[model samples]
Target: MMEQPLPNPILFHPLKHHLGYLRDFAAQSITWPEPELRKAFQRIGGSQLDLYIGPLPSLQIAEEVILYLQQRHLLTPEPYRQHLVPVGYRLCTLSDGSAWALRWGLHTGRHVHLHPGRYSLHTLRIKANHLKTALAVTIASIKYNQPISLQLLNQVRAEWLELPPVTGYTSAEGLGKVLDLVPGNA
Candidate 1:
């Protein structure tokens, strides 16, 4: 049998509408509001909190942390001291605006030379019933953790931009078509 060519996947930029959807999803997913919840948002086109990492130790570290977070979400932010924790976590959104928290490190870590180290990876599914409470917990998680780095920060952003938006379709045939495309420098 002859080989058939694949259909061209949709190529596009990260749309603000999609990002807004992600932020809303994240906010709704967490449900319960907290004092830190406002700060947890990583602003994108406007009030949209696409993906939030941390107040890394410095701009460099913040950048790294953002990059790492980007691999999973649609929008992210530049690193800032205001956001740093002893560690870092990402509240991310799918390209289409579905939200989730990329929890890094165990919620608790031992001090290393007076600096915090050790991270864990976890994913908590969002539920309409407990969105508010979950968001409160996410805020607490990022705030208490240690900082991340700029290299990894940018990595997260790069990764996010590279992927297509999340949609109702499942299986590789859906959004998976982007996998065959080459990545561009963000």
Candidate 2:
């Protein structure tokens, strides 16, 4: 049997790593609605978030925390609204009209840009739902007795993007994927 080939990262935005930002002609257009989300998001994109790790804490701990949250359905990250590359950067679709990749990082340390959508009212709501879910993951870290490093949280986001969307969910139950922790860059 032959191994399957991996997908290529879109060359259109070679160095772009920001989430929700769309670019064309080398100039960026639009900005994220909630700027703070950028910080949380950037860590997963490529940058590292120092949440107590402070120069070499156990990365294993970081990975564990995020997996725990997902197992409980506390964080059901919306799948990457874009390409299926294995790493670094992807062109995500935020909504119909608006898109903004905060001048930040990438997925699993992967980085890329996004393309705009139709800008319909329904798209807007979906965009909002997407960000809300991402932030919900962040909030869980803050509320957690053992705070989860944003880097790991974003890594979880990276892995989640590789999955199918969690549909027909209830607040009481979480996404159906079993708890399997993806190894970290550590």
By lDDT, who's the top model here? 2
What are the TM-scores, per candidate, against the unseen true structure?
A: 0.16, 0.18
Candidate 1: RMSD over Cα atoms?
Answer: 21.9
- Residue by residue across 1-186, what tens digits does model 2's lDDT show? 111221222112311221222111012211223344444334334322111111211222223333433464432222332223354333222223223221222443322222222342222212222332344333333334334444534443544333233433332322211111111110
Model 1: per-residue lDDT, tens digit, 1-186?
A: 111221111111111112222333443434334433343332222221222122222223223334544453422222221233445543433332333333332212211011112221212212221222222223233433422223332332233222222323222441222111101110
- Displacement of the residue 68 alpha carbon in candidate 2, Å: 39
Candidates in order: C-alpha RMSD to true structure: 21.9, 19.8
- Write down the lDDT of every candidate, Cα atoms only: 0.26, 0.28
Which candidate wins on TM-score?
A: 2
Question: For model 2, what is the C-alpha lDDT against the true structure?
Answer: 0.28
Model 2 lDDT at residue 165: 38
Off by over 4 Å in 1: 1-126, 146-186
Q: Least lDDT summed over 10 consecutive residues: which range in candidate 2?
A: 177-186
